[model samples]
Target: MSKSPIHPVSSLDRQSELENSPAQLISLDRVSFGYSHKRLVLQDLDLEIKQGEFLTLLGPSGCGKSTILNLIAGFYKPLLGRVTHGGEDIKGPSARRGVVFQSNALFDWMTVEQNVGFGFRFQAVSKHERKKRVETIIALVGLRGNERKYPYQLSGGMRQRVAVARSMVVQPEILLMDEPFAAVDVQTREGLQEELLKLHEQVSGAILFVTHSIEEAVFLSDRIVILDRNLGGIAHDIKIHLPEPRYTAMNRVSDAFNQYRTDLYLKMKAIE
Candidate 1:
């Protein structure tokens, strides 16, 4: 068990950043948003995702977990506050901020290689470089032999691999995932979780994940942020104390793992 290079931010420091211009990979300053003017799903939400950090947002239904991800991705704008990446305002979606949603979002007509290289095709990358890049990403996600297969031909897990490979091929600075493994079976979900940890070690970016599962949150995140639905703000911020090289064989069944899960479960229950 080795110590991982991840830290949880102090509440005081986090509060101070909203007012000061800090060095952050992504920053949300006093952000507030809702569909209609009558109700605000999130109010005055402040968060900072540092480089190379793995942060997860956990909350009950309708707590605006996905809303925060969308705001950072620039799919939706904040009504009152600001969302920025690298100290610049996020006006719209860009390839630099990659997103992976629950649905695979793969085109049924495109093969794995085509799906992975789609982003590069729009850029000035040559055909040879695009193919090389796609091959590398496919291998990274364990989809080497299935490059010729279409979305309908592969299983749920395989389709998700294609989605991940597609997003990663662009070489984004930040990766945002929303319940990416929620559709798979328990065994497959655990397998994907382990694969994701391995991928995180290889990739160089900050990850902001949204999930409703307590065990999933504890297993993957360096820091977990719990949101209270009624208050529309963060209720608890916890730093996971477990060591690195997380695996289902040893780390998942250890005493420390169970303790973190127990603590996070109680926190979620208390918020409800």
Candidate 2:
């Protein structure tokens, strides 16, 4: 990975590099959406996600954080815009985009292994092969021994981990997550954030993570996009620009951390 450029303009140059340097993976152009013609949630929004970049959409509750994820996932067609993957328009859902909802969405009756294997069920793969992939993801998510357990048998964090494994078992080109860590306790949330940072480092894919926590966004995302309701589009596309090998707690009191956090805090307060 290249060192983060010192000046803010360097971040904009990074966007130019991704757009013109033949590495762009996903692009959203003039994307606008409204469910019932009442009001536009996203208005004239455009974003480019380069390959292997981690981007976070942070906003207050009901401010279209998840709506952006849905638009990318092809869950809803934009009222007046385009969603493209690899330069081609994304018209509907595809296995290439693995989505992990805020809810665990685990089947209560199925074993964890069975739930993870569900990703490949529609592909007509052999049962043995499906079991093998599920087993690998089970280990990947740190749930190897708990494979036979049901969702009810696991802790909230464990269940969320399993949900992650299920989404990633398909080896998607992009992982679209909607506040996956919201329901956990603060301690568990922090630990899970660390776990995600490690997993993201090891794995290479474009990740669009939605969260309300600026701290989490600072630690996890390559770039943080703040959605503003009044602006009706992305109000801020802030780069984290931190040193490599970032950890959750080491820079909690750093000036850079406080600066970034305070800016986002003010933005949130303005929204309220």
* Alpha carbon deviation, residue 110, candidate 1 (Å): 0.4
What tens-digit string does per-residue lDDT give for candidate 2 at 1-272?
22132233443454454445566667889987877677767778888887767899987777788887998898999888788998899988998888988888888999998888887988878888888878876886688899889999999999999888888777677899999999999988887777676566555567899998888888787789888775467778887765545554765667878888998889777767
TM-score for all predictions?
A: 0.90, 0.86
Q: After superposition, how far is residue 136 of candidate 2 from its true place, in Å?
A: 3.4
lDDT of each: 0.83, 0.79
Q: Deviation in angstroms for 184 in model 1?
A: 0.6
Q: Candidate 1 on 32-79: residue-level lDDT in tens?
A: 898976698989999888776679999999999999999999999999
Best by lDDT: 1
Q: How far does residue 251 in candidate 2 sit from its true spot (Å)?
A: 4.0
